[model samples]
Target chain A: MRAIAFKEWLKLRSWLGFMLAAHLVFAAWLYLSIRHQFRFEHAEMIYYQANHIGRIFYDDLRYIPLLTGALIGAAQFLPELLRGRLRLSLHLPMGLAPLVLAHLGIGLEALLVFLALDLAALAITIGSFFPAAFIGSALLTAAPWILAGIAAYFGVALTLLEPRRRYQAANLALSAGVVWLCHRSGQYQAYDLVLGGVAGLVLLLAPASLQAAHRFRNGEP
Target chain B: MTSRLLSWLCLAFLTVVLAAILLPAIYAMAFAPRVAPTHLFYSAVKQDFVYREHRGNHDFTYATASGEHFDRKAFEMSLPFIYYKNMELWGLLPIEIDGQSFDMQAIRDARQVFELKAREVADRHPSVPVHALLDSDPGKAGLSFPEDVFRMKPDRMEFLDVDENRVDPALTDRFTEALAAERFAFPARLVAGKQTILKPFDEGVFLVDAEGAVFHVKRVGDDPVIVRTPIPTDLGIRSIKVQENRQRIYLGLVLTVDNRLFLLQSDGYGLVELPSSGYDADRMDYKLLLNPVHPTAVFGDGGTVTAVALNEDLLPIAAYSRAVPGTTGMIHARISKLLFPVTLSLGTGNSGYLGWTVSGPAPLAFLGNLLAVGVVLLFGRRRRIAPQQMIPQLALAAIAGLYGVLAIALLPGPGPATGATGG
Candidate 1:
């Protein structure tokens, strides 16, 4: 399993590096834009815009994390699954579940590293000029975006892993439904309670992937 | 055995989930809820329903009991003073209403609205949250943002001047001493403050202390006005909402445990309880309109919208209430009534959270599940489908509804003679 995980890490390392650099660029852009606006205008005006007008400064970075997750999943899983390498790989020395989980785990860890760095960059740039209260709310607003990143990775994983075209389409549909739940919220921190359930949905995708592997091993047409 | 168990568990869960999703979608598409029209507005004072037909928004027409209709222009013209701005903009001002020429400025000055919504109310704590008292009497320049936000400790009060990044000992001590003079109990139960600087003028804030004693705290120039209101002992005040109104008649509003409404009058913090009930602070949304003539207070507990009109005396003039049906009524209700004996729902029509519960059924909501399972069983008749596989297939249809049906059709066993894990 360690060997397989290490193999997975080797495959994902390049994508991880790319995502990290791309996200840092985005963070720099967000910070620079805020600074340019605040340089000309009053700090009090920006504060008033948020407090009175209900404007969120970080609204532009909404889908960036989502794309990061989906792309990471695609880069890691799509090539392996589409080439039917996972079918050949499943016959290795260990139990099927651990091998699949370790494979998925490597991709998830890379995505987390990228997200943490993105948040730190946000705190440095936006945090420098804005008050503690406003910056805190902006971070909470970024939570859903990060959650979507995780969901997108798992959804794309399950969709690609299924053997039959019929099952693959159904799995993708179900995966999309779960991701849709994560994005339904309009406000920050509104999804705090239901996040546990969403985690369960993502984990359930693992078992579904194993089932697909079983069918693929049995040579199902 | 372990590997086989994993396979069955996976297949069962996936089957149940897909069945749950598809069954409901097909049933819902065929039989969805209907959009209800607005109902009667019964006027208790006049003993008749004021049948208002809203033609979109401002484009509405009103009719009397005898069916004398007033169009949008005629309606504004009739009220002359109520819709004074509309009349003036349309060159209908200066026309005397009821032989008395109404001053538009006077009417504007007298108009005041303080919306006290229960859902919008902040719950009181044993020890109050953060407090900020703005300089209510900022001289010359009028209302401006506070230099600092003040917080109360158990025995002492402190202020963090955000601009200076240090303690504002002078103003903090002045206000803290005033609270002591008024005998305000420390370790405050609920501390609320106005943070916004956009107002005609600041009206300061209302707070409750450790002993449930309510106090009016404000900054009058550099001096502090911290006085305890004469609220009756043992009165459960849930929250205090401060409103800065031009009328200056009332300092703020208080919503209590009884879902009762009260005005903290400007003079000596006198409390006036308005006639209202059934406003559960947790569930209902309330809106208050303050017009010089006919003010109205409307509150609803989602299922019903209750409106009470008030005269100038702040007493109830007329009341109107109506029942609003729930989502699964009419079409969804009719279909569910005719089809299945039970329907399974995840969250709700409004929310997308994953909460599992069973609702009133569309009896044959599982028809899709049954059909798919039947076809699978038919093909496998010669292969002899095991009770383990066959029973779950049946249960998915019975329990999951349409989504179960779709799952069975989509997720099949590996093949005949191939045990497919648990089997």
Candidate 2:
């Protein structure tokens, strides 16, 4: 467990520099946008203006994690399955669940590290204009981060279980359907819950997990 | 297992927070009470004697008389008929003094004296209608009283008075008989020193002293004219016929007479007349006014008093009225309250564009949901990359967080001048 967690941290560190740069650029753009849109004449007005800026920042921030999860899931898991890497992994002196959990843990850790950096960047940029209540506002602004994290976790688990070209196609189609349903019902808040539940259930019931021990015994590779 | 548990925990927390934010609107919908409705009325009195003195700079006396209730109900019911049918009676009554018509000033003075004597007489009797006679000469037809009286003189000159004491009775009787046959009689009543007759006759008399001061006598029916000095001490007199329905209670020297229209009824406090000036009929609100301009400024509880000033072409140039206080304030308060629920709901949806502008802060909950979707997509995208190649995924996550902060900081505050656009 410790080794796996360490490996995840190493993976996260590789992306730290680029993530920091992107956050800085986005923060500057957001600041300029806010300044152009609002003119604050009093302290109260300034507070209100800050709140608006924060909400916009958070709304766009939520999409990054989910998009990242989908891309990473397709790249890392699908090819391994097509090439029969699962048999090689099963021969290792580790339980299949632990090995899969290790991969998930590393992905989640990298995502969390990136999220933390994003949060720090937001706090610093927003604080310059709203120094008095920066922390409170940032925490309030972080609510989206939690929901995004949950959806990413489910995505990683689903990709590992259904690591085939057809399954990936099916997952993409299903994602579109879920988005459409959410938009039609105007139920954006419940999007993560629905998506997370569906993905997690599919992963838990994956045929790959049940066939892992049998495939290893037969030496199918 | 730990990762799955963490995910479940996060979801549960998000649901609870959303429910908490929606509570205020739910409670308001379920249990908020409605406000009660109210009604109001308004009217005014114009050109009455007290109102005239009040308008002018004169200090006239006032008196009140009480009799058999004066059948106010009958008067009020017949008011419309009287106003439309006999609108001419709305003008000033002509009073002849010493065979000369009295002007506005003299008539005003006579009316004041009549009010005083009436009040004095009513103080004693309190039941009978007091009739105080004015002293005037029957032969002085050429003498003019005052300008206003002259302006109101009858077109026909047949109604004239002649002195019987200065002419032969036989010749005067024939002239008097002819005038009587023509329904013309002496317009002035007789005054023997301080005594005066209140009845109409052919040869009524008046006595004027060296100072031009006059006194009148009282008469009952065709009975011999009573020569009582200073007139009868007490005769019940209530109010002068000014405008229809409005009356001025004699409040000492009437230096200022206000047109008081509606009476406020406080269950335990009896009836308190509301001043026509300060009361706002449209809004049913009241404020204090030092001086009011019109006599007919009175209106009932729910009535409105509008001031209409027209230009030379009779086009309405300016109009003024007061807004009802409580109602106006209440409406503004309600609007302010509505802003809160709408603002909160927007915040919950991560929909920063829901406010007045597309760039404004959206619901925090909405932002959260968006962030959740973004993370899921980001993680999925990076799944095929080497663990060492996760730099771009991390970068995207950072970008999403920063965007969230920017949206919230630009939200507009509540107020009219802020110009926060509606959702």
Candidate 3:
């Protein structure tokens, strides 16, 4: 496990660092932009717009986590598949399921760290102007977007590691569908009721890459 | 084995959910329903109910319930008060209707139009609970957005100044004491106000307290005017919509849990219940048209529009309903029912929240499921799969219908092909 972790760290260190830097930059940008709104516009009107008119100040942050997850996914798996390193990794003493899960698990941990930072930045920014109530609703609104990040990470892994072209296309389409479901509504706490279903999809997609790894090992076309 | 099965199940789940969401949308887009807006009114001149239906090709049909047709000019002449401007424009005013004459000025003052949509009743959007109370008596400066917004907490009323973003203790205590004097239950359930500078004046805020008692709160020249209304506490009020009109006859409209309509009459805060028949607030759009003579309440669902006219004493005088053509019987609708066994809804027209509801047209859906099973069997045969290997796919198709078939076809099942047995 340590050897695999070391190898993953060697491959992912630069990407992870770049992602962390980008996330910090995004957090600062979010804080400054919202602060600019408060400084120029009437804070009361802003609150009214957010509460009544369904205006989302943090809408730009919606797709940032998605991109982060996708980039981390490509960084972790594309090289391994291209260099046929995954084939040798499968020959390791570890079980195939654990090996595939370990790869996905590492990428997921990195994505979660970024998502947590994104959420923290959002909470602090909204908290600066609005009350604690606004913070809760803002986080709830971002819940599905956060789920989209997790789904994208698993989806990229599944698509990249799949042996066949058609199955890869299938995985890609399925992943897009799940992401679309996550972003179907832009309202605050819109998906609060159905968030469990989305979380269930993330749980399912986590173990899904194992099947693709098994198919690759069998040399299935 | 469990992991492989879970993976297969995951694929199937994704397939079904996506297909269920997308297929119906594509079907709806292909066979979009068209319904014309029909306006219903009470013809005080004829002492009957009438409707003007806007049909396709710019065709308009004006008629009464007894099949009495009127030309465009005559239709406007029938409801003199409603079309008072048109009547005056065409030199048809001063005509006596039920022994009363209406000038444009009188009609304009008496005219009240209130539209209630299903989405408003659903309250899907999270509105800032803090309300900016416009000074009801803005005297010279007119109605303006106040600096402080007040929130009705469970125990007391809290005021927050927008500029400082801090609670004003003096203002909060003053209003909280006023509400307390009225014996108001501390926790508020519903607070309705028109928070805009667009209206003629402000009616303050109408609140339903913890015990469902109604109270009116407003600011008039730095003094808080609170009135505990005479509305019964057990009224089970579902929603309250406040409209500050020029007439000052009524403050706003109230919808009860049983779908009854009541006017919050300004005279001593009395409740006047209107006669509503076949009105489901959850599924219908409401239009209450108040005139000096006969007041009419029209409720329109997708398929039909029903209107009830009330006499001066607020008694139901006449009722009329018109059927609006819908797409339920259209060819595409029939085809959709035959192709898709179940409908999956994420967001409904009535509510703002996103939820998942799976409703199947059972018995009719069974046919679609059977057809899906047949298609899966053919695909299995083409793949040279053994019968036992096809069991799970066939069963899923039988249950999820077309969605299941799409899922299984899009996602490969776990395990190797059983083609060796066939060979």
Could you tell me which residue pairs clash in candidate 3? none
Q: Between prediction 1 and prediction 2, which has the larger lDDT? A: 1
Error of 1 at B308 (Å): 3.2
Between prediction 1 and prediction 2, the one with superior DockQ is 1
- TM-score of each model, in listed order: 0.77, 0.29, 0.91
Q: What fraction of the true interface does each of the listed models get right, in terms of native contacts kept? A: 0.14, 0.00, 0.54
lDDT per residue (tens digit) for residues B195-222 in model 1: 5776778867777888889887788767
Per-residue CA lDDT of model 3 for A96-211, tens digit only, reads 88888888878888889999999999999888877667889899999999999988888899888788887899989988888888898978788877899878876677777877
> All candidates' lDDT scores?
0.64, 0.32, 0.82
Candidates arranged by DockQ, highest first: 3, 1, 2
lDDT score for candidate 2 against the true structure: 0.32
Deviating ranges (above 4 Å) for candidate 3: A1-3, B37-40, B45-48, B51-64, B67-96, B122-124, B321-324, B417-423
lDDT string for model 1 (A143-216, tens) is 76777778788778777776667767766776676666566655544454456665676566656566665565
Q: What is the per-residue lDDT of model 2 for residues B306-360, given as tens digits with 9 covering 90 to 100?
A: 3323222223333344322222234433543332222223221222111111221
Off by over 4 Å in 2: A1-20, A27-46, A49-59, A71-86, A131-135, A164-221, B1-423
